[model samples]
Target: MTMQNPVRPLLTPLLAALVLAGCATAPPSLDKALPQTPAAFSEGGVPWTTAAPAEAQARGEWWKAFGDAQLDALVERAERGSTSIQVAAARLAQARAVLGATDANRALQVGLGAGASREAQRGLGVAPNTVLSAGAQLSYELDLFGRLAKASDAAALDVRSREALLRSTRLLVQAQIAQSYFALRALDAEQTLVHGTVEAYRDTLRLTERRYAAGDVAELDLVRVRSEVAATESEALALERQRAQLEHAIALLAGEPASGFRIAADDWRATPPQVPAGVPSTVLARRPDVSAAQSALLAAQARVGVAQAAWFPNLALTASGGFASSELSELFRSSARAWGIGALLSLPLLDGGRREAGVANARAELDAALAGYREQVLVAFKDVEDELAALRLLARQGDAQGQAVDAAARATTLSETRYRNGLVSQLELLDARRSELRNRREALQVRSAQYQSTVRLIRALGGGWGEAA
Candidate 1:
């Protein structure tokens, strides 16, 4: 036992080094923190058998599917100049810089310094002399406890999260622009409908006044006709105001001032693109926001590992070599060389619970990140389901609206024919015309809705399975 004591002392340090190095354990996998995803969406009218293929991905330029060259140009312009996208890009750059800094922490730190100082002796009765020195130093943290590596991994994940967020920002902006553009066109169609009615009312008003002056129709009939014309004009005026506001909004989204931007009265011809209904499981992998949330969770877990490492002892190897002398001429001479090679080991014997607080804080962050990630998943599924329901319901509603438009048109034609022959009262003719106008406007509105819902569904699918993001 006496002979064994000496060898045991030598082996103790080696074993401790191995243990400390082993403390650099990897963070847990994301599956443990993620909530379970549904096998399929609850929304009706989708192809359940179409499991999203592994090769399917989002096309970044989803707006191009609308077949509108103007919209495509606007989206491209916004991609380059939008302030919101610029802000996201700037944040991504910042995250990249932080990652670079963290990675640099793993390398040796070196500095070269030179200084001269004059010293004076008062009571010792000694001569004063200037001290001159020049040297180089280097320090490297050996990552014995894995703190540096953990921190670096966390920073790298942060960069990934920021990058994903950038993509999310672009997707959102493109969707908004499409919705706004379609709405503007719908308004134009409504304006044309209203304007045509105004002209028809003007003709009817002239005929009623002629009848009133000749005593063939009552004065009350003339007043009623005039009132109807005024009300129709008022409706047209309101629609014009709405169109102006919508136009301004589109201009802003296109990254241009309202005063400088204009979209002429082009016919609303953009049709909704047919997007493939992929599997719900594939959607989780496709959404940029969901990816960002997952990355954030990973980064938090890495930070937690770093905090836990604080409890273990730290070890670092250091080496410094330089030449120094009291006289300037001899400062760099070989005879004046000074050198040191050593190792430092630090253990937190007592820290008033500061280290404990750090560990607890890191754990709390991990919990928050986990919750956020699961929430993102839930929201993503909800968005897809909501869009599916809209598309299904809107398709049926548009069909019924088309039938209503046809019926109203027939009624208006028959009523006009009877009024010219004096077979029906003026009020009956007016009622038929009003019904036609309202139904025609409603049909236009439904068409606009179909286009809007289609765009919304595409966005909810995390940019769809066809396009390259």
Candidate 2:
């Protein structure tokens, strides 16, 4: 009694080490884990304007920038009906439920029970006795090593990742709706142009037939004009087929039956809006996919901490209050009352390397998450750059195509006049008309590309430019 026990000295240091380990269980800082970001984007030439921080803001009706009411309605319909968005929302709900379950482990557990048991006596002449018991029990585990906290943190991060995925899904649906609508409108414009060309060709064919009947033109001229008329009509039919397909696509995107849906041909005047590319870091912060990957990485890191905690001893305190009696009717008597209190500390002395394997697996998962996050960031940067390059090149192409169309139209007019005066062959007039049709169709295609690219840029930037709007 006079001398202190030698085990007491060791216990103090052991407890100190355990406390230090618990304190170190927090996940690493995100700044150190994340890859370095560039200060500015590489592509230049278009005016780069600074936009307000959108990381915490909602994307807000970005499709409205196109100034099409029908488009806005379609996007709203898609948002409400898209199966992809519904799936993502369901996943988010599941993650939240898991977080709640993980948190429940930290709260005191309570239970009630009643039982009756009969046991035979070992001695001779002894009869079986029945004992009745009823009780309430409560238990709670002490978070001595931060295991529960780490697990909760991981679950919370999982919820965050699912939330980001839902946002990403919604954005994708909206962008698809915009692109399909713009494409349908482009086809409408092309179809109108082609139908008008067919009418002009028919008129030319009629004039040629009259000339041949009066012997003013050769039979070869009449045949050539007829062929042109047929070819122009065929082109118009092709455009009609294309527009029908586009309408069907838009209907599918809007979650409607293709057979019953239609977009009437109207004037195409929706101009692509100018989108500003903010700083590279800001873009990364705004992208929901990138945010999801980052959250996954953090969750993996927290799981590592949880796995390491398995090596520590677990402590639990339990209490029970109950009634016990040899006679069921007397179970509630004061003399038959029973109560218990317990404190248990358990540590696995030998596990055949199971804990080590778990730690290794957790670390491997953490590495995978880190790599995935890095890949997501790289892809985000690439998307923005690709769309920016496309918009720049498409704008220049549109300008050159416009000039070509003007020149082709003037040539067609002159060729028509010359052929009427018998100064040019019908073949020259046909060539001029073909060139004009080709240039006009190409110009419309370029405009359609501009519209699609603009929508993609908005998606790439994670939304519209909040302040630049």
Candidate 3:
């Protein structure tokens, strides 16, 4: 005990050194929270907007921005049924419960226990003795070294980080549902175009066969028309396959059997919902992933205090009060009462530099967390920038494709009229029909691309996952 006395005396000074070193390092303040300046695109004429959402806070239902009733229902279903979201929610709840438990009991700990025993001694005055005893134990750890405070702070930060992770998971699920829903609708548009093309090809084949029978066109023109019809039929089958696959994906997202679920075929239009791009600073707080990253940093920061607190001595007070008697009838009597109190001061002895190593590890972890946070912010900025660029470029392409479709439709009408009047060959009529079909298909693709791009933009903005359930 005397040899250990010297070791105990040096503990206070070491603890003081640790506390000073650990708490002194503050988290670096980030002024430029979000990235605003976008990378320049190769296409020189596209105007990229920097406007993000005006609301820095997240809303609950982000799918409503698409103005699609079906999409809104699907997102709701996904939120309710998604296993990943449920897991994340459960984790958040666990973290909150842990924080509550740590906070509520930090000041006091109490326990009650009872015991009964029988003892026999031949040499004693009484041949047999029986004792029954009950005791209440109370122990409280004084936060003299701020260890409990730091532990509570770390636990609270863990709750915040867990909540942020839940939000991030929700946002991801919403984005996937939106993207899949739009892609399924796009397939519908492609199927419609394919059917329309098949009809036009059939009509052209009929006209070509009639002219060939009347000696106005060769047999090869009739064969070419029939071949185009067959090809368009094949395109319709391929589109249907893609549509079914998308349907299955959506069903899986909603946590339902794909066999019984279906989305009705709907018209595809290029008018996607207009989302305002807010300032870059808003993205840091609004985006769930970014929020999660920052919360993780906060958690790491709190842990540094926890590590530093290990240097200080822990002060514990314990007391026990109980009633005891050898006779059952006298167990609760005043003469049978017994009480005691104790104070424990646990000072660390030499541990081969383990405490110092702990502080070093905590500092390293904090540095890594800070770096990871910065990386996430950079990735989020790039995501928004990429989506913004895609939207602008696709909008222009859709416009140009619309014009081409109109020109091809007019040209097809003129070619057919000329063929009927014997002013052009069957080849010219077939060419015009093919051109119209190609332009129409391109137009549908462009419209679909635009809608998909809008969905991407909403996802990058965190999809309003911050609402309370």
- The TM-scores of all predictions, comma-separated, are 0.90, 0.90, 0.86
How many angstroms is residue 106 displaced in model 3 relative to the true structure, after the best TM-score fit? 0.6
Best by lDDT: 2
What's the true lDDT of residue 286 in model 1? Answer: 64
Candidate 3: which stretches are off by over 4 Å?
1-60, 121-126, 214-216, 277-281, 464-469
lDDT of 2 by residue, 6-86 (tens): 989657645765775756555556566655665566677333344443444687888898899889888888887787888
lDDT of 3 by residue, 1-469 (tens): 3346677766666666656655655556644543444443223333334434332355667677567888889999998888889899999999999988888757678899888999997776777778999889999989876667777887887887788788778788888898898888877877887798789888888878888889978888889888889988998998899989989988888888899998889875435777553332344446767767777777787787777777767778999999998888988899999999999977676789998898899889878878888888788767767777887789889889999999999999999999889898878988898899889888878887887877777777666433411
In candidate 1, what are the lDDT values of residues 213-275, reduced to their tens digit? 999999998999899899999999999899889888877766788897778888777778865
> What is the number of backbone collisions in each predicted candidate, taken in the order shown?
3, 0, 6
User: Candidate 1 has which clashing residue pairs, if any?
Assistant: 58-467, 59-467, 59-468
Instruction: Name model 2 segments beyond 4 Å from true.
Output: 1-35, 45-54, 276-281, 467-469
Q: Candidate 1's C-alpha lDDT?
A: 0.81
Clashing residue pairs for model 2: none
lDDT of 3: 0.78
The C-alpha local distance difference test score for the whole of candidate 2 amounts to: 0.85
